[model samples]
Target: MNDIFSVLPDLGNFLVGYVTLTGVCSLRLFMVMFIFPPTADGLLQGVVRNAIVVLFSSYIAYGQPIAFIQTLRGITLIEVGLREALIGVALGYAASIVFWVAEGAGTYIDDLTGYNNVQVMNPSRSEQATPTATLLMQIASVAFWALGGMTFLLGTLYESYHWWPLTSSGPSMSNVLESFVLQQTDSLMQTIAKLAAPMMFILLLIDFGFGFASKSASKLDLMTLSQPVKGAVTVLMLALFVGVFVDQVKEQITLSGLTAEMRALSGGHQGKPD
Candidate 1:
């Protein structure tokens, strides 16, 4: 009885310390998983997903000393949690931009192909998307996995703790984040333009040819012919150029770029020694 009682206090303390540390470490991971793909589609409830992230993060963060709350009451805990979440969100946002660009390119192609009206709910994103858009998104997801992007992302997540420790004061990184976001947005537009350029040019040529044909034959209805003709040409062109498109996507979506972006968002500082 005496031995068990003596160990009980230590056990309780360990559990409390573990939970506290895990909660702190999990904040960033939870936010990243919440926003990033293959995990964000509401397939898992937020509470459940958060718990899984917490467990995973806790394992990764093991052996780190716990930073106990100075007070049980007040906003310090909330502030800390929010700050960690913000860091994760920043990283996830950068990662998601590649998918957004892919989808945008697909949407542009769909418009040119007269498939804009054939919209369906994208289960992955839970948004209305053209068939081509959804297909491209899936291709991006597959390529992301095949390229070892997830491993890179998880490694980056682990490194983030070294860069921005749980107990440290939040660094001023809003300006950095803003600048990165603006640069990424500009890059996204350029990427989409490049992806869709060849297809768009072909579609334009098709349109010009159809218009000339319509003018040459007054009674011929060009509207019906134009839609199907463009659709067929788009499908054929896409099949022929998919290799080029995927190669471009792979070039743009690099792990080094993502890691650099996340480091910038975290203010490029290493954690202080405990």
Candidate 2:
């Protein structure tokens, strides 16, 4: 009886520590799952996704000492939760950037191919997008899975704990994060321009030829004829270069790139001690 009574305080402390660590870890993962393209935008799906992430985080966090504040309530807990959420969102945005860039490339091609008028509802995003954009988004999703991006994503999340542990205060490098975001945005635009260049060039040539023919023979509706021709050329170009585009996406959205971005967001900070 004495032993049991004496051990109660220690046991209670252990349980509290375990729960705190798991909750903090789970909070971060919940934000990631909430913002990640594959898991976000669905209420039930988000819940299920967060559950899975929390499970994985729990496994990773097992036997780890609780390095966070002991109290689950108060200003510290609130601050910690907010910090974790920010980290998760930053990581999720980094992961989703590739798909956004691919979609932008497709949108640019649509503008070149006279397909901008053919807009359809995107089920995933609840926004209207050109058919080409929708198709590219779908293809990007498939390529993301085929290229082992899911594995990379999970690994990155796991490794993030090492760089910015749950116990750590908020990220330190605000200027670095701002710069990284600006750089990524610029890179995304450049990538889209590159991807759409071939189609744009071909379509421009077709338009110029049609314009010349129209000036030569005013009675002929060259403008009307140019639309179908441009569309056909776009289809052909896509058929020929789809493999190249997928490979490029796979190369750019790599594990190393994601890890580097995460490290930058976290300021390469080590985990905090209890």
Candidate 3:
């Protein structure tokens, strides 16, 4: 009884130490997972999601050869956790941009095809989105997993510590934020344009043709007729173009560029990106 009682304090201390270490380590991870694929939407609610975060972050803390700061409690812990959270959110936002292109492309198509009025619950985005927009986003997410995107993302997170290790006073990624946001914006527009422009052009031509017919034969119900025609054509075009969209998505979520950025961050290379 004496031996068991004496060991209780030491065991409690050890558990506290592990929690502190993993808690700081998990900050960034929590931020990242909170945003993307497993916003754990729909069935994954509240405490369940948090438990998973704790579990995965615990795994991350143990799996990686992480370096710990000397005094990990009090305000220092809060600061470190905040820093990690910020970095994780930035990286998560960056990583999710590819999927946004997929979702955006669909939303654009829906807008062009007059389908944007209908909104449905999008589990992936964890918000109400148009049908086509939700479909495309879901497809892209599937492709993300099928093509090993999840692994790559987690790998980047794992390696990020090396770039801006928790103990490091300066989060070196701060300098690249502006340039990185610019890059993300440029990429988002270009990719969304590339994917949606073709469909938009087709929809515009259909609109023009219907408009011309209605103007010439002012008696006809082309306004009502236009809706059905556009809907069918939109379905057909989506089916035909979806394959191309998926193929492009295969390349978009490669995430190699993200890894490159992490490497650059670790190498102390911070400036306007090429």
Candidate 4:
């Protein structure tokens, strides 16, 4: 009982740190989901799924008797607490950036593909998006989670403790804000380009085919045919690219270690990446 009393303070601190870290992650997940088109029903499903993934993994990855012993030997509970909270925020931010990149790419593709004018209500941003753009994001989010992205995320989160120790107060608001914008800009453009590549290529073929059709039928109502033709092409391209987009996002997130890296940075670590 006496020993239990002595250790209670440290244990409590660890729990606080763990919960704060995971809470930050949940918000980040929410943000990523925010830019995608989900019905209210879909959004609730996403939230619940994310909660299960986060809480279950947190216990498994961060909760261990040996880990508690390690905390006693000079690992200040405050430091551990701070680190967990900061890391959770960082991971969440990273996830947000990756999804945003996919969405940004979808936006760019819709612009170039002539689908930009067909705006629909977007639940994610509470604005509007071209059908093509919205469909792509929806597909990407589903694919990201289905392909063990969450498991990989958990592993990376665990790895973070070794690579990014929490010795600082985390990044300042200015720094985090700047990094978030800058990283989003860079990754968003790049991901969009990649996501759009296949569609863009198909569109070029489409343009040539349309031109040939017009040349062959010079007297036909070319303007009337253009809309149907373009619309058909858009639908087909979406079907083909949806799966590809998901795979690409999953690959990028896994390869870049962007989530782990970003979380470290967000938590105010000076040496962490941008």
For each candidate in turn, give its C-alpha RMSD to the true structure in angstroms: 2.9, 3.2, 4.0, 7.1
**Which candidate has the top score in TM-score?**
1
TM-score of each: 0.86, 0.85, 0.85, 0.58
* Candidate 2: segments with Cα more than 4 A from true spot: 1-21, 42-44, 60-63, 67-69, 170-173, 254-256, 264-267, 271-274
- What are the lDDT figures for the candidates, one per model? 0.75, 0.75, 0.74, 0.57
Over the stretch 165-223, how does candidate 2's per-residue lDDT look in tens digits?
66555445476468768977898788788888877888899999999999999998888
Which residue pairs of candidate 2 clash? none
Lowest lDDT sum, 10 consecutive residues, model 3, at 265-274
| lDDT (tens digit, per residue) of candidate 4 on 1-274 | 9999999999998777566555433442334333323312345465676765566555543544444434433336545454455445555555655566666766766775677788987555556777766666566556655666656665665555445533324446456667766876686677667766776777667677777887898888564565567678877767776666556556754434754555555463544421
> Which 10 consecutive positions of candidate 1 have the poorest summed lDDT?
65-74
Model 3 superposed RMSD (Cα): 4.0
Task: Rate residue 239 of model 3 by lDDT.
Answer: 92
Residue 243: error of model 1 in Å? 1.8
Q: Candidate 4: which stretches are off by over 4 Å?
A: 1-42, 45-90, 121-128, 165-181, 201-221, 253-256, 259-274
Please write out the lDDT profile of model 3 over residues 1-274, one tens digit for every residue: 9999999998887677778888877788778777765354553576877787787678656753323534777888777777788887777877888778878888998888888899999986567998888888877777777788867787788777665655666534466666667877898899889988888898889899999999999999686777677789888987987787777667557565677765664456332211
Which prediction has more favorable lDDT, 1 or 4? 1
Per-residue lDDT, model 4, residue 2, is: 100
| Model 4 weakest 10-residue run by lDDT | 32-41
Indicate which candidate wins on lDDT: 1
**Residues 84-160, model 1: lDDT tens digits:** 88888877777778787778989998988788999988777677899888878777777777787777778788777
How many backbone clashes does every candidate have?
0, 0, 0, 5
